[model samples]
Target: MTTVAVFRPADERLDDAVALLESLGATPVPDPMLEVDPTGVCPREDADFAVLTSKTGAELAEAEGWDAQTTTVCAIGDPTADALRAAGYAVDVVPEEFSSGGIVSTLEGRVDGARVEVARSDHGSDVLTDGLNDAGAYVHETVLYRLTRPDGAGESADRAAAGELDAALFTSSMTVENFLAAATERGVREDALAGLNDAAVGTIGDPTRETAAAHGIDVDVVPERADFESLARATLAAAE
Candidate 1:
């Protein structure tokens, strides 16, 4: 039986990945590699536009009393836009392609002189903010969450060593680092990575590919876009 390991944290949003794997007749295994903490980050205010890169960022903004009425919100993809809309934000833009480059491109002509505030995890890349700044838009950033290594490293690594997973999906570079850390902690680094090689290694975008390659693991698939659905379809194609 083929088993697909999901390396994201345990969240209600994982339902899509779980359902997708089930539809492909692959065993679904939840091997969360990281955890999200909403504390320890500050929020910013007063901007022409608000950039939301993840659903977690949306949740954080909602928690921090950010009103969407005065700010035009931009989402990285449809799912994030959905989250923003549900949070009562007026989502003005959602790129068809969900990568940072796509988001930047979508905002090129749209935000020439606008002050854009970016809300994201503490360790997130600065590609969006930097690109926006270079495009003549004043960009402010708010780190609303932090990602930590999971405490269940041993168990997750043991499952990898047992050869139960046919593949592992990585949505971000942090996920790659955390998964490798888990494998190292369990003293099964070689076995875990070998299991990944035997099956498939799925990356959401170029940055994720770089992260996987730095660990000497050749990524097997990268979706055209960086959304969860695109990554899942790429993983399924790689499995076939």
Candidate 2:
């Protein structure tokens, strides 16, 4: 049986990844690398637009009682766009690729002079905000959550070292960094990461691919779209 490891920290996203794996007839093993604190705050206002880069960010905005009334919600990709719609927000834009760069490119010509609020994690890069600002949008960012490495990083590393996984999926650069840090803490960083080369090493996009490459791990698969479904399909294709 082919086993896929999901490295997403959030339970909700991990569950979605596992479900996608099952639908593809692959066995999924949860190997969350980080934990999310869902109670962070992202200041929301009746802006002309809102940007959601991750499902966690979207959830945080919804929790903060962000009114979607006549406001255009732009998501990084389809999955995040789905989340925004589920939260009763009008999804105005969804990039074909799901990355900060992709979101920036999609909004380059569209957001000029627009008041846009971005909801995201505490430690995320300023690429989106900076890009929007450069494009003449009045951009405000609010941190909605924090991500910490999981406590069971050692055991997770052990599983990887034992070759129990056929592939590992990384949705973001942060996930790659946290996974490596966890493995290093367990003294099995090399072994755990080396196991990935034998199987399919999947990334969501270019940024994540760069992160994996920085650690000397080559990414074998990158989906056209940065969603779990696309990642799963790419993983299967790479495995083939």
Candidate 3:
């Protein structure tokens, strides 16, 4: 069976990812590189618009019983929008492009002179706020969660360095950074990268792909759709 590495948070998300890989006939190396640390902060109810960038963010916001209070809700992608809707929030916008730039483009004209609340993880890209600002939206960011690599999480890094993984899935730029950090901690950064280069790599989105590129990692798969299942299936299929 093809051996694949997945770097989701050490939660139900990781379990679901592992199950998906197993169902696809791949041996999964479930090394979680990100852990969620909620900030106990909620989006201000006074904003004209609110944005959710991840499913986790949607869940967290709902947990807080977040009342948009007339704020139009927007999500960057379908998954996020679905998450919001499932949480009983009415989604008013979701960009066709499924990215920060895409969302900014979708709302640029309408958000001018409007207050936009951004609720997501600490690793959110500056491209989001900058573009919103450039478009004349008053943006306020509320960090719903902070992502940190779990301790003793380098098994996949070791496997990658040993040329044991057939493919690897990176969901976010932070996951890529944390994976490389794990390799560095094991003093196998260069070797691990070499091994990964010999295998297939996939990133969930363009920002993640650019991060991998900046770190000299070669990406073989970037699905037309920005979702985990698509990313994993595409990478595993490429590995085969």
Candidate 4:
């Protein structure tokens, strides 16, 4: 059986990553590198616009009672938009690229002189802020959640060092950083990465791939779609 290393944060969406691995005939090694903790903050419901980059942010918005009836809601991707819709928010914008650049493009003309509120992860891209400001929107960015290193981070690093993992799935830049920290703690940072160099390296999107590259890991598979299921299929194919 193909043992795939899962290095995403432990969250509601983690099950989706595991399920994708199973569907692709891979045994998931659950060594979550991070966890998302809410900052108990929300965007202004009275703002002219709101931006959401992740499901966690959307959930936080819902918890903070951010109604979208008056605010123009913009989501970075379909998943985020779906979360908002499920919470009874009407998403007015969804980028085609599912990145900060995409969000910037979507709000290019509409944000000038507007009050834009962004509820997102602490580690979210600065592109959105910069873009909004450049477009003359008074932006208020709130840290909705933080991604911190979680337990069992060293498990996948250890397995990689032993050549037991067939693939390593990286869903975020934070995952890459935490995985490396785990490997470093095990004194197998080089060996683990070397082993992973031999195995299929799966990345969720361009940002994760850039993070992997910064660590000298040339990704073997990058999903055409920036989602876990696509990442799993690409990893399986690359491993084959």
- How many clashes (backbone N, Cα, C below 3 Å) per candidate? 0, 0, 0, 0
Models ranked on lDDT: 3, 4, 2, 1
Q: What is the lDDT of residue 188 in candidate 1?
A: 95
The C-alpha TM-scores of every prediction are: 0.91, 0.90, 0.98, 0.95
lDDT of 2 at 201: 88
When 1 and 2 are scored with lDDT, the better candidate is: 2
TM-score ranking, high to low: 3, 4, 1, 2
Candidate 3 versus the native: TM-score? Answer: 0.98
Q: Model 2 Cα displacement at 189 (Å)?
A: 1.1
Clashing pairs for model 2 are none
Write down the lDDT that model 3 would get.
Answer: 0.93
Q: Highest TM-score, which number?
A: 3
Candidate 3 vs candidate 4: the TM-score winner is: 3
Clashing pairs in 3: none
lDDT of 1 by residue, 186-228 (tens): 7899888777777777899898999899888878999887777
Across residues 142-235, which tens digit of lDDT does each residue of candidate 4 receive? 8888888976568989888898888888988888989999999989999899889989999977888999999988799887677677778888
Candidate 2 lDDT over 166-192, as tens digits, reads 787888888888888888887889898
The regions of model 1 sitting more than 4 angstroms off are 40-43, 154-156
Find the number of clashing residue pairs for candidate 1: 0
